[model samples]
Target: MKTVVICAGGPIDELAPLEPYKLSDEVVFIGADKGSVYLLNEGIIPTVAVGDFDSLSSEEFLDLTNRVASVKVASVDKNETDTDLALIHSLDFDPQQVVLVGVTGGRLDHFISVLNSVYRFQKDNPGIQFIVRNKWNEMRLLTPGIIKLTTNPQLPFMSFFAFHENVEEITLTGMKYNVSNETINIGSSRFTSNQLLDEHGSISFSSGICLLIRSSDQ
Candidate 1:
């Protein structure tokens, strides 16, 4: 089944777009403390809530315990971050796709860490599709394949970053600005932000991994 695992980090500001995509049976909420309050406020109860309750008040914690189907509480002193643990648990269900929400804002460190974790998961499980969505942008990790992207006119910025050393034979088509037979390496910001010319664009890489960020100013 297609499951969207919502991580309990960052601000839950862009959750409206995600409402229609949520499946009652397949939705999993990883409430990292106060995130439970966000879910409750939205009138959506999580199927499984996992996190340390440090960010929530006693009453909020109690409310989540009562409302959620199952609660997996962790210690404040755990090796993995709450979001990491949540992602691991989500994978246990063997979902077709995992979309992480409320995971891209606030502290810069946390945001980078979450993106790194997504790439790590992609490396580990090549078949699974994972994405991070926010109000302004949608980010996904790509590995050696052609990907078709449909542009939202409101959100015209499309960028690609090579996460590895040898990203070879990268090509783009249908974009206002295209790259051809390019080698995008780590530490290079050459492909930072570009505009989409058409309704759709495509990207292909012969080797290595890249992170694609499709964003908008408005």
Candidate 2:
């Protein structure tokens, strides 16, 4: 599969509209734990399901296994979380893109864990693009390089932050709040809420990791 979309077991209210993804034939859906039931509820069947499944009843687990072609059940005590396991499984296919949805609006601990995991996986698999998406936000981690993006009308607000340390020589062009050769430090809010001045905008950082988030009010 060129694109693998993981429906995680986060709050359903936080998930991006699933109907669009369900209608797309190009995307492969992977359900993580309770996410399997969520997908089924939305009339989308996941090809694979991965999780410890403590969140599901015995009957529900059985139903999911029967419906999904590939089911991977792990120990509840395992070190990796259910979402992380689903992400690992997604990499087995070496997809060009792996998107994570239904993951950003639940527990704070879980969200932070997923965010860090995405950062780690993105660094490890530079060829694969990892994304965290929700009802109103899309996030991606960029290493030291230039990234050109077409402005999304739905998500006009763009924000960049240093991953853990200082990001040096940061540059932003074609943006409403353009900056040049700047430095963004950890815990800095200087780059928040910038919009694209044109149809396209560019971001470049010479050092450190940058986290880019495009968001909307909705």
Candidate 3:
């Protein structure tokens, strides 16, 4: 699948190592601001670099330009955050999936901002899948449909929540806690930390969005 991975400049400890992503097929990397430095440190030259880049030192910035293929600079005072800019640019490839990494941790507001962007993008382009993955969590938005899931041995914990409103006609199978024709209302914690009973499972819903989070114990 065609995928665009946007790396933001969040806390390094919170960000998962990019080595695995570098080996994915048909993947393009976008470095937002200091994210370029982070990618370069891991020996991955980004296809494009987009952001204000005020956080980088002169030497670091120079090294980024010398290494990365393209750099799309934005104003520091621009309305979009670095991650937001990266998201916008990611659509240029019309990728089948947009994966965001290094966007969580450090400042909560920044993480929320990226999530708001993800919501908007998911609404605008329903065909492309949007994902936000950090060291401990992998988050995605589930629209009204039947979604097949596979167990992630590394991320054994899974949680689901109603996105904006109550999700109706929910049916789950192959899960430890299966439900049928149920509703997950806003602020419901009933589905938190559920596990897949088998290698595969399914979640079917008819209305509203669901936030699916697969987490690791770490």
Candidate 4:
């Protein structure tokens, strides 16, 4: 399966560790705007760079252009953000999984936009594994389906939130706070901070989208 990892123009240092994904040949990396600078600095060359690149200095932009073989430059006045452009570009690669890094911990507006964006992205493109990962959290959006998850000792806390207006008939097994046919409405916090009881767990829902967050205390 092909995987696309997008490094966006957020706090790069806050992204989850990169080592685990570096060795995979199936993974393609793309840099969005200032993210190109971070990727180049880390010695991780991008398959392509996309964005208006307004955040980068002229010299840094030049350096990025010189380093990357393919660069898609968007006009500064474009309506969509750099990360949006990057996500659109990612679909062309026909990736099985798309991991978004450096996409959190920025402006409040941007962070909120990203949250909505991921849900719309998943709804538009079903069957694709879309994830947003940072130092403390790994998040996934599930749409009315059965999701099997393995317990990660590193990330001890697991939480679920209703992404849509009403997520119905929700069920969870093999978890510390298991539920059966429960309904979670949007803006509710009842399902937050649950734990995986054993090596694996399963979550199922009949309707509406669910946001699953796996996180660490540290």
Best by TM-score: 4
Instruction: Write the number of the candidate with greater lDDT, choosing between 1 and 2.
Output: 2
Model 3 lDDT tens row, 144-194: 999999999989888999987788999999999999999999999999999
Residue range with the least summed lDDT across 10 consecutive positions in model 3? 13-22
Descending-TM-score candidate ranking: 4, 3, 2, 1
lDDT of 1 at 14: 57
TM-score of each: 0.91, 0.96, 0.96, 0.97
Residue pairs in steric clash, candidate 3? none
lDDT of each: 0.79, 0.90, 0.90, 0.89
Ranking by lDDT: 3, 2, 4, 1
Error in Å for residue 164 of model 2:
1.5
Give the alpha carbon lDDT tens digit for every residue of 1-218 in model 1: 56756656576675426565554666655555566677777777766777787888888888888898788898999988778877888777778788887887788898888888898998998888888887888888999989888878766898888885568899999987798999988888889888778788899999998888888886
The residue-level lDDT of candidate 4 at 130 comes to 90
Report the CA-based lDDT of candidate 3 relative to the real structure. Answer: 0.90
* Residue pairs that clash (backbone atoms under 3 angstroms), model 2: none
lDDT of 4 by residue, 1-218 (tens): 89999988888768777777788999899999988888888788999999999999999999998989999999999888888888898898999999998988878898788878888889999978899999989999888889898988888899899886689999999999899999999999999999988998999999999999999987
Query: In candidate 1, how many Å is residue 18 off?
Result: 3.3
- Can you give the lDDT of residue 72 in candidate 1? 88
Task: Point out where model 2 deviates above 4 Å.
Answer: none
Candidates' RMSD to native: 2.0, 1.3, 1.1, 0.9
Candidate 1 residues lying further than 4 Å off, grouped into runs, are: 14-16, 23-27
